[model samples]
Structure formats: C-alpha cells, structure tokens
Target: MAEAAVTQARVRLADREGFLAWIFLTPTVVYVVALVAIPFGLAIAFAFSDVTAGDPSYDWVGLRNFERVFDDPVFWRSLWNTLIFTGISMFFIVVFGKVLANILVADFRGKWVVRFLVLLSWTTPVALSSVSWLWLLHSIYSPVDWVFRELGFIETNTYWLGRPNLAMASVIAVHVWRLVPLAAVIMMVGLLSIPTDLNEAAKIDGAGYWRRMFEITIPLTFPLIAVSALFGAIFTFTDMAVVYILTRGGPTNSTQVLASWSFLRGIGGGDIGQGAVIALFLFPLLLAAAVLILRAVRRVETI
Candidate 1:
C-alpha cells in the first residue's frame, strides 16, 4: 500500500510540473496568436480583398491588388530604395561598429563614459532623434551646413532635403547613425566572448595584431557579425519613421522605402488593399534573408 501511494504521488508531481510548464507557456502562445498570427492572417485576407476605409465589408479581389502594386513604377522604386538603404547601412554599421567594439574591449580610463556615449543614439527615441537630425540638416539653419560654409566646403547653406540625391543620402546617414550603436554592442559581446587564452597563444606564436585580427579574431566573430547584419537589415528595411519625419518620401519620392510607401498607399491614400500588398512584399524578402543568414551561420558553426 505504501509503494502504491508513492507511485501515485510521483504521478501527481509529474502532472503538476507539466501543468506549470503549460501555464508559463500560455501567455506567450496567446500573445503570438493574438498580435502576430491574427494580424498576419488579416493582412493576407486584406491583401486579397478590396478593403476600403469607409466599408468594413470587403470583396475577394484575388491578386488584383498585387497586380496593381507590381505595375506601379513607384513600388519598384521604393523596393530599390529599400535595398540600397539596407545594403549601405549594413556595410557601414558593421565596419564602424567593429572598430568601436575593438576599442571598447580594451581597458581604459573612463571607458564607462565612452560606452554610455555609444549608446546615446540607440537609447534615445527614434522619432525624436530623426527630428533632431532634420533640424541639424535644415537648409537655412543647419549646423552641418553652417560648419561646411565656415570651412569653405560650400559657399552657401545646402538644401539637404530639397534635392533627391541629397535627401536619400541624408536618410541613409541617419539610419546608419541610429543603427551603429546596436551593432557595436553586438560586436562587443562577440569580442568579449573570445577566449583570452587563444588570443594570448596567438601573440606568443608571433602573430602580429593585424595578422591575428584577420586570421583568428575575424573568423570566429564573423557569425555574430552576420547576425548583427541580419538585424540591421531588418531594421533598415522595415523602418519608416526616420524617412517620414525627415523627408516624407519627398524630393520626388527618391527617399521612399517599401514600408513608408505601404503606409502612404494604404493609410495615407485610403486604399487598404493596395497597402496590404505593399506590406506583404516584405514578408518573402525578409524570410529569404533570414533563412540564408541562419543557414550560413549553421555552416560556419559546423566548420
């Protein structure tokens, strides 16, 4: 009878643990279903339906919305702009972030202060930061333009947001500035995780700084860098606040990216179906990028 009681108690304990596990998982499951899954389903539905602001009722339009989006040159332009923005931002974010991480990894006086400074752009609200950048690049009162004029780089204040190329460049610059800090923090983590003994052994083996960095430091840290690049690309690709606040896709829609264009079409232009199509375009591209990056990381790990 005692043995039977013990076995029953064990079963009860196992059941309790399983219940607790499910309890912990329930919130996350519910949240994803409600916020992510449900919205995604709605987006898919709306993309195929003729959804309008005045009418909650929608008719099944099939691929008509996507067809319209594909035919629009503005859609193609926005897609190209998004690619350019993401690509350029990723390149510079990695390069500068890696350098900053290397510097911060070294022991130094007031290193904490430097670290705080590095995080300023990231910690500040993006909208506020973008607005500040707009002011700094303002045509008449721009501090950057004033400094340039003082240094004779140009004779007059430059209209940064007025010209198409300049507006695109400014948008890209702000994006890079905003994203670099996060990249640096990621790089710092990668740098810190490197075994000290391995680096010391490399030093003892007569591996010079650049040689060790190129051969050992980079290869091991490359996987983490790729992760940072992936995140930066996603952020740049989906981000619209900076572009909206800075240029509103102005100067002939030169700075317009996919996300902003979607907003402009769907909400701003009051064509919900077309907006859904534009928004959905990001899904496949992002999925492809994520799959490729993760596969590459796995391959590197196997090596």
Candidate 2:
C-alpha cells in the first residue's frame, strides 16, 4: 500500500507541467539568488555604509558617498566616455553583426571554416586578446604604426592609445570587434529560425534580395537584434577590462569609464562606499536603456 501510494504521487508529480517547470527552474533560480541577488544586495548595503578596504566596518553613512560622487569631475567625465563607448560600440556592433549574419546564413563553400574563424574573436579570453592589442598599439615599435606608414597613412608613430581622441576610438573599436562576432552569431540564429517559405514566396513575386531583406528578414529579426543590442550594452556598460588593460584610463583619464572608475575608487583608492555608489548608478541606466529598447521593439512590432 505504501509503495503504491508513493508511485502514484511520483506519477502525479511527473505529469504536472508546473512541477516540471519548477524542477528545471529551481537550479536557475537558486543560481541567480546566490550570485546576482546577493551581490546586488551587498552593493546596495555598502553604498549606504562607510565600508572601506582598510576599515571593513559597516557604519551607516547614508547619502554622503553619493554627494562625493556627484562632486567628482572625473566621475562626470567617465560617465560621458562610457556613454560614447557604449553608443559607438553598439552602433557598429549592430551594423557589422547584421552584415556578418547575412554572410553567415548564406550558402557557400568553406562556410563552416568561415563561421569558425568568425567566432574566434568572441571565444578568445578578453584579457589575453586585449594584451595582444596593447602590444600592437604600444608606443615603441608599434606594428600598427609601421603598417600605417607602409600604407602612407602616417609619417611617424601614430600613438593609438596616447592621444585622447584616438584612445577613446581604440577602446570603442576593440569593444566593437570583440562583440560583433557574438552579435552576428545571435542574429544568425534569428535569421536561420525564420521560415524559408516567406523568402521563397517573396522571391517568386520578383522581390529582389535587398527588398526581401528589408521587408521580411529585418522585421522578423528585429526582436533578436534588440536582444543582441541589450547584451552588447550590458557587456559594454559593465566592462572595464579593455579600458584598464589598454589605457589604464590614461592620457588624462580620457578612456576612463564608470566601471573602471568604480574599481579605481573602491579597490584602488579603497573607498568602498563611493565605489559602490558609482557602480550602483549603472543599474538604473541599464534598466532605462533596456526599457527603451523593449518599447522601441514593441512600437516597431505595432507598426
């Protein structure tokens, strides 16, 4: 009787969709709580306290840290740089990603090898890749400078990461380079998921390639493009590795961003409260950006 009852319950549990969903979802929920939620709560707590690397005591400081952050000129400058970094990187990432995705989805010989090569940038560890770029852009014996000279683009060392404008551009370029492959892969999935019948019908109606793309492909893949953009924005907003590794916010903090600035303050400067304040600001900005993206996507869908 007991065994029969246990088997019946097991069968009932297995038959329920809700139970199955919770079963598969439990691990993800627990993972988010443990990693993301906990860290976020800690950051909020620290932002309101006087926590520091040296002090380590959590004394309530309220809005004092916020005031200090607002007063810092570097904070504002870094914020501007971060906006430019994320904006320009995202623009190129989307445009290049779409072009690459179209190429990727096309039928051709050596397509597999092309796909593999394209994914290498995304797969490579960021620090290792950034270090290689640093070597290329280093003032002494720069291969980029030599190549430019060979091509008659410059007469001397271009100092890619030395000039303020060039440094910002280099950071954005590297960021776009790293992210475009991932975006391409994402849009490729979207493109591949699209029903082939739609394209065939359009082709039968004498729609050219560009017309089919603008009408059918772009509309269907709009959601995925937004998804990729969100991913790129999150990565770009939170990322300081490229900036730290390449320029170290050098040439007068031209490449400095909120993420790097937060690290400089919290860890490097040992002001945990102010650092948390700086880092926490990214949350709302990200949230707003995502909301706007979703709204734009929805508006497009409606139209």
Candidate 3:
C-alpha cells in the first residue's frame, strides 16, 4: 500500500508544472551554487580578511585592503583601462556583429563555410587563440606587417604589443575579434525571428531597406542587441585570460584591467585580501551595466 501511494505521489509531483520546472532547473541551480555562489561568498569573506596565497589563514583586517587598493596608482590605471577596453570592444562588436549578421542572413553560395570561419574565433579556446594572436602580433615575423608592407601602408614592421597605445589597441582588437562572432550569432537569431511579413509589407508600402530597418527591424531586435551588450560587458569585466596571455598587462601596465589586475594581485602577487577587494569593485559596475541594459531590453519590443 505504501509503495502504491509513493508511486501515485511521484506521478503527481512529476505532473505539476512548477515542480517540473524546478526539476529541470536542478542541475543549473546546483552548478551555480557550487561554482558561482560559493566562490563569490568566499571572495567576500576574504576581502575583509588578511588572507594571502602563502598563508591560507583568514584574519580580520577591516577595510585595510580597500584602503590599499584605493591608494594604488595601478588600480586607478587598471580601472581606466578596463572602461576603455570594454567600451571600445562593445562598440565595434555590436556594429560589426550587426553587419555580419545581415550578411549571414542574406542568400549566398558557400555560406556554411563563411559561418564556420566566422565562428572560429569564438569557439576556439581562449588560451589557444590568444597564443595564436601573440604569434601573429609578434615583434618580428608578423604576417600582418607583411600584408601592410606589401600594400605600401608601412615601410617597416610595427610593434603591435610593445607600445602603450598599440598594445592597448591590439588587446582590444583581439578581444573584439573573439567576441564579435558570438554577438553576430545572437543578433542573427534575433534577425531570423523577425517576422518576414513585416519586411514584405513595408516594401509594398515603398519603404526602402534603410527605412524599414530603422522603423521595424531594428525596433524589434533592439532588445536582443541589449542582451548581446550585456553578455559582452560581463565577459569583458570578468575575463583576464587574453590580457594575461597576450600582453601580461605589459607595455608599462597600459593594457591592465580590473579582471587581470585582480588575478595578478590575488594569485600572482599573493595578496588575497587586496585581490578580493579589487574583485568586489567589479560587481557594482557589472550590476549597474546589467541593470541598465536589462531595463532597456525590457522596455523595447520583444522579438
């Protein structure tokens, strides 16, 4: 009798929509808790404690770490660089991604190859791609320089990663290259989901491509654009791998950002508290960006 009752209860629970929703979400919830929640909580605790990589002990230190991070000139430089890096990357990413998405949606021959090539940068492992870029941007033996020289654009090889401005530009360029495919794919989905009837009707009404795009297409896809921007901001704010691999925040720390700076201080420099403090600063900026972007998405037309 108990076994029969248990079976009936299980069937009822499985049939319940809310219960099924949680069941489907169980893996994601567990993953987030184990990976994100725990690490974030520990970081918060470590921020207020005098923890170091050498000594794993957590000793309460109040706001000393925050004070130190505030006074560090490198921290200010990293903060500035982070803004510029994320801003410039996001601008070009969205613009180029939109253009690429338009091309992707157009009827063409051998589009499968184009799509595969476009996705290569995003799908490739970051470390591997960064290393490849490092070779391409090498002080000597750069094919990019060869192309430029052959075109009469320059007479000699340019130091892509050895100067402050050029290093920052190179890092931003690589980061944008890696991310644009993802943004393009996302915008492509939004583009595809746009109803064809709308475009057709607009064309019948004598609306040109630009007019229809501004009036109907862009309005509908604006939300997804914001979503892509949100993802870009998050990736930009948290990623340190490219910076670490390509330039190592070199050229006099010109390409340093909060994410790489935190990693450098917390792990490499062996100051856990300071590193955690630096990391915590990222949360507010991210939160603000997310809130603003999400708000914009919510207010726009749904795709």
Listed in order, each prediction's TM-score against the native is 0.93, 0.96, 0.95
Question: For candidate 3, lDDT tens digit of each residue in 1-303?
Answer: 999999999999889999889989999999999998999999999999999988998789998999999999999999999899989999998999899999998889999899999999999999999999999999899989999999999998899999999999999999999999999999999999999999999999999999998998788889889988999999998889999998999989999999999999999999999999999889998999999999888777444
lDDT of candidate 2 over 156-236, digit per residue (tens) = 998899999999999899989999999999999999999999999999999999999899999999999998999999999
RMSD of 1: 2.6
lDDT of 1 by residue, 177-267 (tens): 9988899899889999999999899999999999989988888898989899899878987899999999999888999999999999999
Off by over 4 Å in 3: 1-8
Model 2 poorest ten-residue lDDT run? 292-301
**Model 3: which residue pairs collide?**
none
Q: Tell me, by TM-score, which candidate is best.
A: 2
Ranked by lDDT, top first: 2, 3, 1
Give me candidate 1's TM-score against the actual structure.
Answer: 0.93
- What's the lDDT for all of these models? 0.91, 0.94, 0.93
Clashing pairs in 2: none
lDDT of 2 at 98: 98
